[model samples]
Target: MTIEWKGVMPAVTTKFTDQDTLDLQMFEVNINAQIEAGVHGIILGGTLGEASTLSDEEKRILVKTTVNIVKNKVPVIINIAEQTTKGAIEAARKAEEDGASGLMMLPPMRYKAGDRETVIYFKEVAKSTHLPIMIYNNPVDYKIEVTLDMFEELLAFDNIKAVKESTRDISNVTRIKNRFGDRLKILSGVDTLALESLLMGADGWVAGLVDAFPAETVAIYELQKAGKIKEAIAIYRWFLPLLELDINPKLVQNIKLAEVATGIGTENVRAPRLPLVGEERKTVLKVIENGLKTRPELPDYKNSDLM
Candidate 1:
């Protein structure tokens, strides 16, 4: 499957059993739901997918499982959030070998690399892989900004093809467009900012909450593209509260709770991280319940010829 680098590509959560093993069954269920809801691609082992805690072997299994499940209907992408350049390269090569169509990579984690070092790390990894890459430019959360100058240097690499724009500054979408034109595809990484970013000319959405509400997420993107602004805005307004959960510190837990409410997933998270509980869990659940109760009837955006 060739990655078009457009449309809704979910950064899906890594499903785990109560014993903390990969729950391939539930993972398949969610991936199937995303594809059925009209998402463009599957991203495995991302921030939402709990990349840091997953073993290298587990990540490979996820890529392979998604590849088989998606069966070439859509591209399966793996996220590389390694702490070292060598590790990142190895992960990229392994993902390609595991049949991933593309990669969504973060800047070298833990160590805050300066501009030169960051660019070097990305270039070296790009040099190592044949697969198309989407640089996860999430300076707000990751703390290492891949500024335009660094991007200019990275422009020499043909495979460094796109960016997951999560800076939270909506204007960065236009800044990227102005600087690179169509040289790099920009996918809005922040959930709450997705529609606005799309309106600002982002090529796609690297969506987080689509794990729970895939249909609503895809509808917003498809409707916006089809020039149905009034319909899109109606859903977007109702979706804002649930979308806000993605920006929280406990986003994985919060979204998994939402998934549980929707009956598509479980709330089991690997430790060091745990499932939401007590008042916090109650608060998140209220938001999810409200969204579910008032879930809007979607127009036939999927069948729109305009898209």
Candidate 2:
């Protein structure tokens, strides 16, 4: 299947049982909600999905299950974050073999590679699989900025198709458009910047908090695309405090808290990560509660068939 690489693709949180096992039943429930809410695609094992802690076998299960549940209703993309180039290639190939529609790849994990090494890592992985790739360029979190020059090097492969632009320098959205002119499709990776990125020509959003409020997330993107800027901003402003949750260090915990309040997912995460508690938990829940109180009456919108 051809991945469209556009519009409100939630970096879905991986659900786990109390025993820390993959909760496939609850996962399918959440995925069905996303589809019903009109999300364009499903991304598994992403940052929001706790890719860093998931085992390879677990990741493959995620990819296969998502693909099966989605049933071609949307593309199922898996994230590949590994420390070694060979490991990255193996993961990418595994995603393809497991029936993923695309891959969202980060630069080599842990050791921040220089520009040269990063380019080589991406190109080699792209060479190893036929799956389309969305290069995740989030210097603020990932520490390796995929500069336009580096992207120029990656253009040799047609499968290296899109970018998840989380540089946090919003102007890079414009710079990417100015420089690449659709040669590279850009998806806003930051929730707070999603509106600005769309206005500036980003083709889509790989959202975080969308896991909690799928209808509002899809509505904002659809309204913006339809030129209802004022309507879009109203929802975005109401959403800002909660959207801010996506950028913080504790995003996974924060978002899961929102999910539990909204229903459809659990707050249980793996080892080394705990559910939010005390004032931190209260503060996040307050934001979600307040947002819910005034939640916009979302107009019915269909999923973008922009592909």
Candidate 3:
């Protein structure tokens, strides 16, 4: 499957039934909705997808299900969050075996390996699969920056083709472009920074809240790419308050709540995580509600675009 890899590719959340099993039916519904909304790709088993909490079997199932449902509409990229090189290699191989078109790999989780260990981990995993890889560089949350020097080392692996630029340092976007040029596809990983990152040359957005509001997320990206900067900024300014929700630790719960409000998915999440409550829940709901009340109309946006 060929994916443009240059528009909104949501790091979709994993849906669960009340009993906490993977909600395959609802998951299919969510994936189909995203495809209808003109998303350039779909990434499963992301942090937002509750990867760290899901069983290995469940992760593979998510990959296989998405590949089948997506068909050739767009790339199905699976996120691998293992703590060991061997584990990451195994995860990448599993994703490829299940017919995934690409992988979004994080550095070794929980252990915070330094530069040498991190680069080695990515290289080893890249060798194990033929799928194109997007190295997730979220130093703000992951605590290990894949510095430009580190990326220089990664350049040896031809399959290491993209960077999820979530350093939260907006300058990194330009830095990556300056250092690597077209060697890497820089995708903005933070929702609040999506517009800025794009303005600075990010090729796409690996969005979090788009799971709830796919059309708006995609519309902003399309507007910006079309050189309609004023229209894009207008939509992005209105989106900023809600977009901030994706950067917090509670993002999973917060985004799922927005999904529930938007009618795309449920707010149910796995344990060690809980549903939003009290003021936290109310505040997030108000943002979604207020946005819906005054949601901007996309130029040439249509109901059929969502079919």
Candidate 4:
């Protein structure tokens, strides 16, 4: 299937209340806001969404809510990474039934797999669902590398159509583009590498900061696509500090902080992922303050609403 995935696909967060119940309204509100802001697509239950912490029922709700809100206005990619192939496949089936446009899958974590084993894990999921697969190579979180060779092996499966390259290496991105450019779509997953990814050869970006700054990310990407290189770079530079800050394991906290400071989602993330406080809060605030200082004077962007 030819799934046209492109532009800013936010790995959107699942909003939670102070009592830790899912704030479905806030989540839908943000999804609507992101769609209205011109996001190309949405990837629910990814790292930014705190997928690792959510229960299966919560995930179903998140996906169902997103599909209902988006209404096929754009593609929806659901990240399904579990310890067992069966669980991942089950989730993918449910996501397709719930109306996800495709599935982004990561191999089982903690227990590292060899090349053959990794391929087997994904191939099992690929066979289970008709939804397109986005092979996720997130070495930091999963501790397993989906190497170029492993990718080539996975590509033999009819459903594995794309990849989310989170390794943050531009050369590797170039290599993948050169090799599999014709066969599969490659999405840049690292926020800091979004610009370089586009410039180097990535088809799109799965942006974490899009939770708060969809316009900036989409604008830079659209600018470059339109061949306005200088304009794109200007925005890229303006966005670097914000992007760099997202690489922190405290990404959920940082994005929520941006959401709270600006007029986006709440600063409330689920526990284990606490709201920033003490020096951490001060550090994030300083970074944001400095980022805003260098940010271009776009009219109405820095208005009282975002403040």
Per-residue lDDT value at 168 in model 1? 91
- Candidate 4 lowest-lDDT run of ten: 298-307
Evaluate model 1: give its lDDT: 0.93
TM-score of each: 0.99, 0.97, 0.96, 0.93
lDDT of 2 by residue, 59-126 (tens): 99999999899999999999988999989989988988999999999999899899999999999999
Better candidate by TM-score, 1 or 4 = 1
- Which residue pairs does candidate 2 place in steric collision? none
CA-lDDT, candidates in order: 0.93, 0.91, 0.89, 0.82
Task: Identify the candidate with maximal lDDT.
Answer: 1
Ranking by lDDT: 1, 2, 3, 4
Q: For model 3, how big is the CA root-mean-square deviation?
A: 2.3
> What is the alpha-carbon lDDT of model 3 when measured against the actual structure?
0.89
Clashing residue pairs, backbone N/CA/C < 3 A, model 3: none
The parts of candidate 3 lying over 4 Å away from their true place are 301-307
lDDT string for model 1 (231-304, tens) is: 89999999999999999999999999999999889999999998888999999999999999999999887795
All models, RMSD in angstroms: 0.8, 1.8, 2.3, 4.1
